[model samples]
Target: MLVPLTRQSFEQLIPVIATSSQYAYYWGKFPDFLKRLLISVVAVVVILLLKFLLGDGFDPLLFLLGIIAGLYWFWSPVYWASRRNIEIRRYKYSGFWQGRVLDVFVTEELIGTEENVNNRGELVIVENRERRLNVEVGDESGFTTLLQVPLRRTHKGIVPGQIAQMVVMSNQPDLSRIANKSDIYIPRLNIWVSDYPYVQRTVFSQVSRQLTQAEEDDYPANRVVKTRRRRR
Candidate 1:
């Protein structure tokens, strides 16, 4: 038997059925406040300089040239430098995992239980969560690194032996092959150090250490600093 619907029943269900939409917008840009400031400063300075030199003449050509000079002085370098530093740089993607960081030291060789394998031959191990990073030299000048990251929580989402996606910037396509277990380098995910989670620093330091030891100590002029995203 169907029970008849009533107004009181519909009213009681309305509040529970309504869902508020929440929007999270990442990487929003601010209005160019500095651009306005640059325009104002250039207008004032050019007017004053022309008043001293041209003595209040109705010269539109001189005014245009002065505007161009102001733009070059104030905004051109800022715009170009920001563009080269941010838009042109390449970035790697680190994996998302449901586990806490386990800071472990990396070394030439270590003993741990087999964890899992990704499509590449990288090895996963059930080792100490409190581990230290170690960089080791591998075949053909290949590099190996150990990273220690804190595990914030425990979850079954990432089993004891599972390979997760992690990305690193590499210029050589050959380096991409190293993530496999058969390769010399192994990659891990969800690792954090000094409260900053990620492997970029550890990876760079390890590479630098290996390079220095190999007597190839030279800093590239165009090294880009890896920055962490600000948490809301």
Candidate 2:
């Protein structure tokens, strides 16, 4: 089922930024924390090098620039969060769509590697593997997509046939086709799975609740209409 979303709030973007930063290496890439640290270190090194070369002639503007760079590095997550929001807003319309979980399975995935030292003091590269849950979901529109997330203890209860919902954006107001990648939210598990944070989750949850309540209220009335037609 698809329900139109008429409102969105950016106030919850702080949590989205936090989640994205926390899962920076979700796709086996360099972690955001380490990346920011590296940037800060590089900026400091460059500033010191310029100071050493210029002796007493060093420009204070260089120092100010280095500080600005550091601030930008720290604020990168917020920048990305705002970009995601703008991307979502570019669509003519957006809606919440609930589909069924067609399949659920777990697979071992190599996330990265770590260095370990043996008793001999020799460093060895140890492979890091994580269990990932792959879920296939589809709706009546025949649109099917696979979502993968690192398997966690709390996610052990996810099974087939559960309701999975996502924010669907489209260039057309009717939302005939999806215009962007949306994070999947499993209402039953109360968990979200995605390569990146794409939706303002708090708003999504509120919309989901409203849609579910509306559906429940309409079911009996629709059933009564069907029964009356049969009697005729």
Stretches of candidate 1 above 4 Å error? 1-43, 54-61, 65-82, 85-87, 90-168, 175-232
Distance from true location, Cα of 91 in model 2, Å: 4.1
Q: TM-score each candidate.
A: 0.23, 0.67
**Per-residue alpha-carbon lDDT of model 2 for 78-186, expressed as tens digits?**
6666666565566667777888677777777889999999999999999888777777888888988887877666666656666778877777778788776477887
Off by over 4 Å in 2: 6-35, 51-60, 70-73, 80-92, 112-127, 213-232
C-alpha displacement of 223 in model 2, angstroms?
25
lDDT (CA) for every model shown? 0.32, 0.67
Writing each residue's lDDT as its tens digit, candidate 1 over 130-199 gives: 4233212222223333333332342112222222222223333433433311101222323222222112
- Which candidate number would show the highest lDDT if scored against the true structure? 2
Model 1 / residue 71 / CA error / Å: 7.6
